[model samples]
Target chain A: MNAVADITQSRITRRFAKLKAEKRPGFVAFVTANDPNPETFREIFHGLPQAGADVIEVGMPFSDPMADGPSIQASSQRSLKFNTSLKDVLAAVRDFRKLDQDTPIVLMGYYNPIYVMGPAKFAEQAAAAGADGVIVVDLPPEEAEELDVHLRANRLHFIFLTAPTSSDERLPAIIARASGFLYYVAVAGITGTKSAEEFAVKDAVARLRRHTSLPIAVGFGIRTPDAARTIAHHCEAAVVGSAIVDVIAQGLNQEGQPAPGLSQKVLGFAKSLADAVHAAQH
Target chain B: MSKVEPRNSFRQGVDENGHFGLFGGRYVAETLMPLILELDKAYEAAKADPKFQAELTDLHKHYAGRPSPLYFAARLTAHHGGAKIYLKREELNHTGSHKINNVLGQIMLALRMGKPRVIAETGAGQHGVATATACARFGLKCIVYMGAKDIERQKPNVFRMRLLGAEVRSVDKGTGTLKDAMNEAMRDWVANVDDTYYCIGTAAGPHPYPTMVRDFQKIIGEETRVQILEAEGRLPDTIVAAVGGGSNAIGIFHPFLDDASVKIYGVEAAGRGMNSTAHAASISGGSPGVLHGNRTYLLQDENGQITDAHSISAGLDYPGIGPEHAWLHQQGRVTYVPITDDEALASFHLCSKLEGILPALECAHALAYVDKIAPTLPKDHIIVLNLSGRGDKDVFTVAEAMGEKL
Candidate 1:
């Protein structure tokens, strides 16, 4: 596919290129949009870039997140209480774009919300709102054509997930339609549930690298800075989702309101992870 | 509109990509896709294997009590005073429900695939009990995920599953219903893909599952077809069954789909009413969306967030319907109607009083619809309703609904 050429000049492509030049692995921070509250989430979104997030994955909350573990599921529930819509998520990206044009933002969630909004409209709106890519946890390669076509036409990257269970015979089919990067799900389970062994992730990344030139980002279990540092040593980027979401969950008061300095506290955790990832060397 | 050429067969469906028109495709995470595809291949092989067929047939006859009598409900037929009603006695099957038919097939397939542990999700606990029983028979480990609220109301079935040597895990997330139980089950399958076979209760999940479950459960319709023809010398004028995830309904509906002369009706639970938000009527009240690994009619909000579904019957209280039901509904081959809680309760009592048989609340919804249309048809007209399960597990709920302490 011409997907690689299509996204050559995109924000995601540029960020990874810069990371390769610096000889440092990138750090991707994930947080549910409007989590805790819209205003607090906005502050966290704006602060992510300065806190050293090479790429940002803004979670679009849905009612049923089948692939998610307790942490991300709770995060989505908290975000939904504020009525976080896809439009609101896009608007967050748009606002973030005004302050920092270089940081790449990818919206991650299930397919039902995007399917409800209409695929073509979602792609157009996402591109227009300055989002660079999408990672639909439930939309595997087999069922991705409808949304992928629209994303390709909009010049936005459609990131596909490769799991530990994704066999070598299946890698070709998965990577054939992939763009931006391949997200190597470190664990065979749902998000935030189990940590991946560094050796296993290293081997899996090596196997994936032999097939494509796309940058690989490992996710699903890297929670602490040490784990992030070790995982980042193998892939182009290390992604931490539930870990940061857990920080936000912990920062919430008993009344379900964000305590004072919750945004700062979440950003602080992201900074520590980013520092560890950026410090990774070959 | 121009005259459309009628298709040769309505039974042919679900293209290789696991779609029924715009519905029913593999919409699971990448983690489960390879395993689901593997399952599809195993199922196809088993379908063509004479040994597998013989074994399933043997189990159905000797183990689960096959050919559950197609009882002629003479008293109810006279009470309706119009259509001669027949009840396909699936309730007489082992475990007191139609769930065993599909469980027997799937658990046998799990053995073939060498997956020793089996996991399942249930709202009414009928499917759990069936799976647990199968696991006990086969000596495979069994884990059943049940919603906390469902476990509370369905205490007897929960106890039955435990007695059958299954571990029951309570899921308290997302309104603590079937939807939540399904989510937990998927998580378990994802985490334990190597040895665990996810025995989905209904025909609603991803491909191979919808088709596989229907294939196993189609004995209901196959038997009904033969029994009705022998008794009435013709196919019934109409066939009615309740749809939750639509396993039982699809089982009976698939065999008669090609018969143009026969009419079909699928009932959905309208908890309070269709006008009110409380209901499990996906086709009648909701629209098409993807959930639980397949694209089907779902009770979702404008933002595509799934809404909680309500029904007096735990078995019928799910937010989505099987993709095949969505296809059949869209094709206009099967008419889907909503039956309210009060209507179902009345029928539940009426059928018991008239036929000396207590039908499941899920089946009562179908009887409620039959109660509406049967009286309007001629006495010579025949209508067959699937008695999908026995109501023994529902006595406490029914008594409470009747405001009785017992």
Candidate 2:
């Protein structure tokens, strides 16, 4: 509707369109910004596009990440240990935009930091930093308008998460407010705790498709390449977060410092998952 | 009474969307949104149902001991030589605290909703014990999440919860305090939404919780109103209560909010001093921020990261206050003050020596404030303080603070 919205929507919409043209599902890689250390995180982030990622979701670290599982929670803690701020997360996006312009970048986290920064300022700064979308985990459609208006004015997609508990009656409200893509949390539980059955996701995605034309992205408990492939078959994209973070965790020393080649290890796993997702039948 | 001018009522808050002047709302994940809405509907229905009220009243009178005595502290009043002080004995409730008042109501709702499992989080294990006791009575599976540090400091309460047949799960994440325990409980509820009901201990969580908890615990103020009138032939001029998550304070404050003649005080735990970073006074020392599902005053850093709170009493060691308290503070309906750990400790010893009642450290914060204010008021002025909990669970922590090993 607005100039900024058009510009931001094109990045994500174009990527999904490109994937659709190739008759393949897109791969989205999620990582907490500045995790393990900013330098290594920068390296991994810059390599995601080359590793076949269609979109990048950067987590803005918060002290209390209630919706996240152990892996993402630990990664957030690691990032916070370095005193990573929201400014640092946007800076990471700016850096990634310098190297890769085509891949859509979404910043995700709880609302406290954004509320602290003021929603209008956060949306403006994020758009200036080249971020395309946002996913505030705790802000459902009911509470999204305060931030959504600012985000829409800035041309950033105010992405909404539709959970397993979102019934037919609830889907309409969520769909009406959602932009960019709908993140269908495959499981009703917190991230990485429970695996989503393929059949259940298929039915949920089908139900969502009947309501809106917006592309659906499945996340939560998508760990291995096979699981990613299976889930990507049912939606426009499959998001892999905690599993990729697990690689970074494994590459850390006992003292919690990043080991040598930690970035490569994380990027390598992301590549494998991406390859599987791209190879899946539409 | 003089001719009263028409005014807005403070009790009709938390509009259908669950807000109290931009302070309270449902700030939970999408997975819990539908369930929270369902809970809101169920609560509204139960509120309208007379049978629900009758059942809760029966349990309060027979099982949990309602209408606790309002006793005049003559010795303490004589010592202060100022206002006559009266203590509302919530410590005499079945679970040795006022936590049972809300827990019984919530546990009954859990049964009505057909939820088989009940989950809760606690700081000093008072709420955990109350939840366990209620679950044991109703034959529901109860799981209590307590911080590892709290489980150690509040070992007696942990034991009490376990003996009551509730599973006490120690949360080792973050600072292992009330906030961490709450985070873990939310995660558990999200993972097991269908069969589980989260019984929030404080009047602070998302929409319905803040309003519902206050409604359930409002019985304290209702009884206090009648008792004070019967004893002194008039309502007290001032009422005081300790505030952590602010349940006790809000419970007693809500009924008297519109009483223009009545004054209210909420005492917060200033661990060392408000000048130092170590304090749990959200109103006095913290800024407005979102935490534990509601927007309220919180102890947080510049980056909006929640900072740890410090208090001698675990029950008062929290980063955020109830949203209603935030709104009331903003509207100047109530006055909030800070009490240092030393001040509370002095009142603890003083109340025990003077009144023969060992007050909970949480309640001692209020007593400490009364010690300061009551001595300054005229002897004719009346002050009623909510003695919210007993000190048995806090004895070990107090002994340790006193540097006397058991």
Candidate 3:
């Protein structure tokens, strides 16, 4: 398996390498882009890196989010009500880039939008807008070859998600093309369904360690600080997506509008995950 | 002679990687990889086993009633004016549609693979009822995911599914149509991988499925080829079938691929008009993209968000078409055209009045296409159209459209 992404120069690779140098797992916060509204989303987005997030993952709100549970799914629906498009998501990334340049923002979602934008153009636009990487939830490694061509040409990292069911036989194909870091989905089910057992996650991380040199970031079902710490113990990064998004959803008012303290509420939750992940290192 | 050479076989088309000339490929989440691989292996083994063939043949003959009558539509032919029209009466089969043909074979595979439960996604509920019927026969627990709107529009079939002891779960997300139901079913299969088998309704989805469902369904074309020969002492000049997920179309077309003289026509649902946004003509109106675990022609916006598909026939109401149909459309071996809602409705009434056979709205799309072209073909030319399903399930929808209460 040849390495498709030479991620050594990318912000994502740099972040992972920096985390390794500090001997601490990075805390990656996940939020829906333009979630609730751009103003509320901006507050959450700008405050994320400062709130102890080492890397930020922004979801490109898709109509059909099969991999996500109800929380993230609801957040996407809320943002879509404002008619948030790929342009808005890219604009959000560009805005975030203004305040923070160090924290890598990976635009994660399904492959359809990028396919619509045409992979090459999407890679160019995503890279131009300061997106560090892209995680297409539905694009398996087999089909990733097409997008890989564009991502490679643009020097944009194309990250692949590995699940518990991604067998040893299938790893070589996936690992060959994956760059920046491997996203280890901690549970077999959709995100935010249930917390993955620590022993199971450790076993998975250990199994994945034999396959690639890329940093592994574990996500899905990491709903608590303890769960974040547990995942941080085994992987290079802890990705708390639906859990942090849940706080934002909770902070919204009854009229489906973002409340005054929405950004603070989300960042405060991110701070807890960051503190736990940082503590797990020592 | 044309410069391009003919392929030896259509069966050998989808490579081991599940690609049919860049159309079909597994684009699913990783969790279903092992299961898909396992199913592929199991299907290969079962396909080679003579005993499995014997069992499937027995079930098709006795239970589902195969060799479903290839009837010469004398009145329809007269009404059409030129082509000698023949109807492949798949509607007369058990469960009143061609859906049972695929369901029987898949349930047999599920049982052989030692799966206790079967999960399926349904649009018009024909597949759900068919699947529910098969599961009852095998005494397996069946769960079906249906769009909430479909559950409302297709109430009788929903009741029929429940009466057959299958649990029908309504998917209320994202247009609440076939695609969302398929997504929910995929999620279910991912969550409960070990104990369940996903019986995809059409020649769609990841490899093994487009091929396997087509294999289960290719019986339609195979039987048609033989039956039409017996009826007219030669092959039909053209084969026409409705294309939704393209099980029936691919099924009836696969056996006739090498028969160069037999022009194949696939009719897709053009709900209002192709020029308008409201239609289910994926191949005619959509561009190639990944959806429902396979890369194919999909009705999606520039951002790749799947748009809603509208059709009076729930069976044809999908944002994407089967990958094989997409490939076939590209290869120019098959011609795909769209028929609008009113045209199909008029054909639905025409078929009932002219032939005394009520056709499902999905099948009526094909009948409507036949109505358009049959009048122009030579009198000696034979046209075989797949009446894929009966209109029993669509009476309510039809009535509603006619401004009448059920």
Candidate 4:
């Protein structure tokens, strides 16, 4: 697993083939950068793929990630406690590039860290670290031009968000410069799964199609395989972040530590979601 | 007072760039950047949508009860000696305060955004109750963050929020008051940026919020303009209201911002005294910094660690003033004055005794200024004061402050 070489464009083909060969839907998993421990970041990137995560989004922790829910916020708080600065998240990405890298790794989270680091430095650091893309949760389409140009120059994809409330007029403007995929927030609310039945994920996905031709990946509140399957039929991919994090959070052992089951739980959940996606595709 | 309906006074001091007279700009953590920009875009469309405005208006009228009355206080004015006094009775509004005016609008916007949950922070708990009411009415899951200290002082409000189906989380951090509550709320907002709609209780927070919340609350002033005319046949010489995060003050002042002849006074709480350490007079003594989301006058240190705020009135015990108030204060369009805890208490008692109206401790600060200025004014001069909230919730706290707790 050459981390740097693995993330190169050529490797993405193989990564895509592996998922196709396994008859599993490609799963993009997002984990807040430096969560639990910044030092163990290499493990998170390497471990996630082994656990059935096809693409990994390492969330660059920010002081205010407005799109996050309590669990992710707590994850960020824990990361910040270890003095996880934007500089550190970028550094971890650079370090991760030293190991295995064929996985499609995108940086996710807020704009403040990027703003603080300056767009050029952030872009340079991200590109140098072999990050494929970046998703700034709060960057509006109107104000993303400067960021979009910088990320593109550095060969990092600038991903944009589309929500249930997003209109046709704003959708193209938001995703015009987007690379990789369009993240359609399946639920109107923040990140984290509630009752799948209560939050209409299918209606949200159906609405997202009118906006962009890019591969629409639905996220937010896709906790169950059924919910994932329900979303997969309407969208190209389904993102499961918070629900997986919740599994890791719940599987913590008596020592106030994430035990062996954390990995198993995530792998099983991802597999189920992939199965749901496969089921829907057929 | 010109027989026109109370309405939004479509004003945007911040241009397309989101500035409020150099006071408000996006000053936030990196994580919130995308979300703020997203919110800004959504708010822009919502602001221009006729359907959005109509829906908000409908909620304001049917749900929150708009156009609160403008009643002439004949007895109270005579007691003041010379000035004719009028009260814009916002206390009579549903949820018992002017806080409902903005929440109804925000909640409606949230619904339009397809947001399923609403989150807010409160000090005196009036805002919390109003937000909870909106959440309940709109069928959204509501969560309110309150300072642990405020929870103790404003117990009834906490209970009311619970009854309204809001999960009240007591933030036991920092000074354990409004500042801490705001910090906790911001943390929550950052975490839940995906699906949660942050119902800012005041005209504070980030760029669009200060401007948007002010626009929503301006209905108070718009209505006051017409109601005063119907009640008095002319615009009052003065408009006065208490300033916590300055929402009500802005609500009453925004309509009259262009009316040069109408003087506006914003009453700030001079807890103990402004000269002393015990005070919540941000404009009177504090400097500008970023907190929660926007850059505004904050009672904070150089490191942006917010300081402790003190006031006899829990509602007025906040560490920041609304951005618009800072602009108004600087532009000299309005005077930001402070009344001591003692003065506010005296005014509270005076209003209860003189007009048979028990004002909220926060509103008492506004009353205190009237008490002082009315005696020296000309007989024909009329002053319109915003009775921001009812005193029922404050009775127990007031009793304790007066050393006569029930």
Candidate 5:
């Protein structure tokens, strides 16, 4: 993407466009930034796109991840134990830029740390550091002025999440300013829960489609390949977060330490999810 | 009493879109936006209707026992030998705390919204008991989320809630205290938004809750204003209340926000000490951040993960205060203090001995602040302290702390 014309277009938007051109659904992978340490985060950061991640979500760990389930919360704690601030998370993205620059990297977390860092500076820094988008779990459309204005000004996608509990009246405002794509949460509860039923995902995707032309990415469940494939059938992409974090968690030994080759375990999960998405795209 | 800012009202702050300066806003998930907006509308309508006000007043006067005595603390006043002390007797309320006032109002609004169930998060269990009592009286399904740590500390309260017919779920996440319990309650609300109404125990969460709970609890300040005039013929020189989620303090502070002469104090728990890692002093040492919805000052580490708040009093063990209070402190209209565990504990015994009143440890934080400042002020200076809850549930805790087996 060139700075003169394509700076306004995020890697996320480009990914969606590419998926549309190929007539295939996209595969999104997520892992907490610096979950164990910087070395471990770099492993997942580079491995994701290679293992078939169309978009990468790097979690900015917060102490209170209210919307996350046990697996993601534990992952956040692991990151925080090493004092992994937003600066480090951005630095990780900047580091990833040295090797590969095509895959979209979305910094996903609660709003506190970003608020602590100052929203304008955060937006500018994220853009400068080659980050593609931001998914602040706690910032709804109504209150996102704290970050949205700055992020939009920096030409970064302010990715918003929509749940089944969202009202019909709420959709217009939600998608009105959203760029890249909309993240459709398939479950009502926190992440790492059961996958949503197929018919329900179909209805929700159809409902979300009525409001925006932006590609809808389904997430928050669909841990297995079959579930990911099922969701990818109707949506433009499938995002898996907790399942990959769980793989990282399972790879860790007792006393809350990461076992060896944790990144490879995550890559294995990503390969399976990508294969499923590609199979369903046909 | 100089410095009267005329044309000022409690409503002067918190702009049209739910903000105290830049502090309070709906920083929740998109799923909760519609529900919060609907609640805002319902509350606005209900607040304007005379019928709703009349019913709330009736329930307050008869059921929950409104006008819970503004009593002159002659003993405390004599012992201090300085300012005349008065206690806003919230401890005398039906559920034994100021928590009932907000619960009664929120439960009414939940029913008005046609919600079938009510959910709440509690640390000391006083809010849980009050919620259960209200829901039982109204015949609504009540689910109170309590931290496992608090459940262990507050065994009697857990029994009281279950006996009063409320389901108490023990939450065991993130230090298993008020913050984690609130997170669990929020998750439940997100999952069951259609049928459940989340009755936040304090005035801290996203918009409308801080405003609504403060409005409901404003009776404390309103009553103190009228009652104190009857006893001493003017507003007290200062008003003090402990700041947990800042509900009681804001409740008392709101009505007097325009009264420039009336000094307001919100005493946050300092745990062992303010300099130590274990303290709940959000605005004092902690910087501003967002958690549990609203953007407020939070006790967090370098990484912005909310740290565990330390306090001897479970009620005052929260890491964040109400957004309005954060704004007030910034505006220099209210003074926020941090009281340590030893200080609050000493005041607990002092109040018990001096006035025959067993104040909740949370309220003792306020009382402790009063003890520090009351002796410094003149006898003409009157101070009103919120006795937010009784200490009956903390008998075992006190006994154990004193090196005696309960």
Candidate 6:
């Protein structure tokens, strides 16, 4: 991955083409803030881009993320216990930005933290820190006009979700305002599973096609190569998150000592996912 | 689809299409993706494993008192002036509420996972007392986080938990209510994730929690189906229950989810009135959003921030409803209605005088709805009401509400 791309060009379009040409689907890895510890993030943030991650979604920890499952809940709790504030997360991203600027980064999570911090200020700090997009999970497209406007004004794409259950009537509005790419939730449930019926993926992608030409990225439950392959055949991109979190959790400090090869483990896993996407070539 | 049992609504949670009508789907964070998948796998295995189901059944029968009585309330029916009334007496369960059913299920899973410590939060003290009771029975170290205000008002339950050898932590931040207590409990669990199991009180958390809790509590409806068959020789015309985080109601309502002939009424605490700012009617006044681990309807502000709620009953003061309840409401199978504080208080005294049952303030909300709807129906109509808990915990609050002190 290049450290710097042409600033004047639409980098998202450029990155999409390069991945498609290489017969490799784009990967967006999502991880909670301050998992294990904040300091450990230095390696995770920098290593992901080098390991072929097209995008990184950093979770902004919230006290009550109702949409999050136990693993993420635990991660958020750990992060919050270490006092991983919005400011702290921003600083980590800014520092990571200095190391590499090509890979687009999106902060994904709940809306309470951003609301408490003030949306305008959050967008400002996020944009200034070199975040390419923001996906507030709880902030639905209908309720996110102001936040979307602020982020767009700062040249940051506002990512939105189009679920299998989302009505055809609501798709156009969601697709019209959405940037970066539309996150088409392949299954009707939480993330982590590698197996969901293939028909569900195809149905959602088919429905989304009738609405917009924007790239449709299937996420939630797409964990392995087979699942990614099935999803990539129907959508433009495939997201793998829980499988990576599990790997990172395994690489955690073992036997009361910090794992020495933490960065190596994450990069190895990312490379495996990238390889999986590439191996699924038509 | 017609079943051998002849059910009413659609069974959409079966993953054929991944929905319960337009309500149930996986809307969650990426970090917990693997854990949820694991939980789904575990649940699937547990469901098919007779050993797992038998163990849960044994615990329920011996510990939580399975098949809690279904009594005919002839006097309450007469007082209502028309419809026949039956009470599913879950209050007689191990911890004096319907919460024990789900706690037992979760505690068994916690043990299976080799988790050593059990943690939970409570507002009315029913779930806390029940969780503590389960931990005591299982010989697990239990820690319960309760809001400071709840602790003060629910001293007897706090003492009961302590007597059961569980540590009770009081949370004093963020309105010092159920939501804050939940936040603190989640934080503690996260801090001790390696050894501790966060036994959530209600079927309102993320993914498997809501699904798992519902399954455990479904025994209510399962038993009620047989009990009603024997009692009235037919299905009741209506089923009424209170909706505090909506666990008990959902437990009783799930087996009947597809039973179209049975009209299910979930009573939410209106605090003062539906229009008042003090109400806890998330279904009546709130919109769908994500909070407390599920994408369900919640009483939130314009900015989508969860709002603090109020009710005379501590358990019914939550601003969010169970996701399944949201699904039921959207599917139009269950009618979500609000009963004001005055109505609940009046029902409490009336039920005490008429039936000699001092109903819990939370249950009183359901009773109030029964009082409202029963009189309007035909005299031969049957309405099964879930008396969720005993009113012993509400003595002090009831006294204050009635302008009488112990």
How many clashes does each candidate structure show, in the order listed? Answer: 0, 2, 2, 36, 1, 10
Sliding window of 10 residues with minimal summed lDDT for model 4 chain B: B3-12
TM-score of chain A of each: 0.98, 0.98, 0.96, 0.83, 0.96, 0.89
Most accurate candidate by lDDT: 1
- The digit string of per-residue lDDT tens for model 1 on B280-344 reads 99999999898999999999998999999999999999999999999999999999999999999
Which candidate ranks first by DockQ, i.e. highest? Answer: 1
In the range A14-64, model 6's lDDT, one tens digit per residue, is 667677787566777777767757767677778887776777888887766
Query: How are the candidates ranked when ordered by DockQ, highest leading?
Result: 1, 2, 5, 3, 6, 4
* C-alpha local distance difference test of each model: 0.94, 0.93, 0.89, 0.77, 0.89, 0.77
User: Between the candidate structures 3 and 4, which one is better when assessed by DockQ?
Assistant: 3
RMSD of 4: 8.2
For model 1, the DockQ equals: 0.89
Off by over 4 Å in 2: A1-9, B1-7
Q: Give the lDDT of residue B77 in candidate 4.
A: 87
What DockQ would candidate 2 receive versus the native complex? 0.84
Candidate 5 chain B: worst-modelled 10 consecutive residues by lDDT:
B2-11
Instruction: List model 6 lDDT by residue over B251-317, tens digit each.
Output: 8888877767888899999998987899999999888766755567888765445677889899998
Who is ahead in DockQ, 1 or 4? 1
Q: Please compute DockQ, using alpha carbons, for every candidate against the native two-chain complex.
A: 0.89, 0.84, 0.72, 0.07, 0.74, 0.07
Candidate 3's residue-wise lDDT over B1-406, tens digit each? 8755565555566888788897898887777777888999999999999999999999999998888999999999998789999999999899999999899989999999999999999999999999999999999999999999999999999999999999999999888989889988888888887799999998998888999999899899999988988888999999999999999998899999988888999999999999999999998899988787888999988777778999989999999988888988888889999999999999999999998999999999999999999999999999999999999999999999999997
Ten residues in sequence with the least summed lDDT for candidate 1 chain A: A1-10
**Model 4 lDDT per residue over A173-276, tens place:** 66677656777766545678344432465676556666655556777777777877776666666788887667656766655466654555656776666666
Where does model 3 exceed 4 Å of error?
A1-6, B1-11
What's the residue-level lDDT of A76 in candidate 6?
67
Quality class of the docking in candidate 2, CAPRI style = high
What pairs collide in candidate 5?
A: A63-B305
Report iRMS values in order. Answer: 0.6, 0.7, 1.3, 6.3, 1.3, 9.2
lDDT of 1: 0.94
**Across residues B1-406, which tens digit of lDDT does each residue of candidate 5 receive?**
8655645465575776689987898888877777888998999999999988999999999998888999999999999999999999999999899999999899999999999899999999999999999999999999999999999989999999999899999998888999999999998888787899999989999889999999999999899999999999999899999999988888888888888788888999999898899998898878888998898899987657788898989988889989998888887889998899999999999999999999998998999999999899999999999998999998877887898987
How does the DockQ of candidate 4 come out?
0.07
Q: Write the per-residue lDDT of candidate 2 for residues B185-222, one digit (tens) a residue.
A: 99999999899999999999999999999999999999
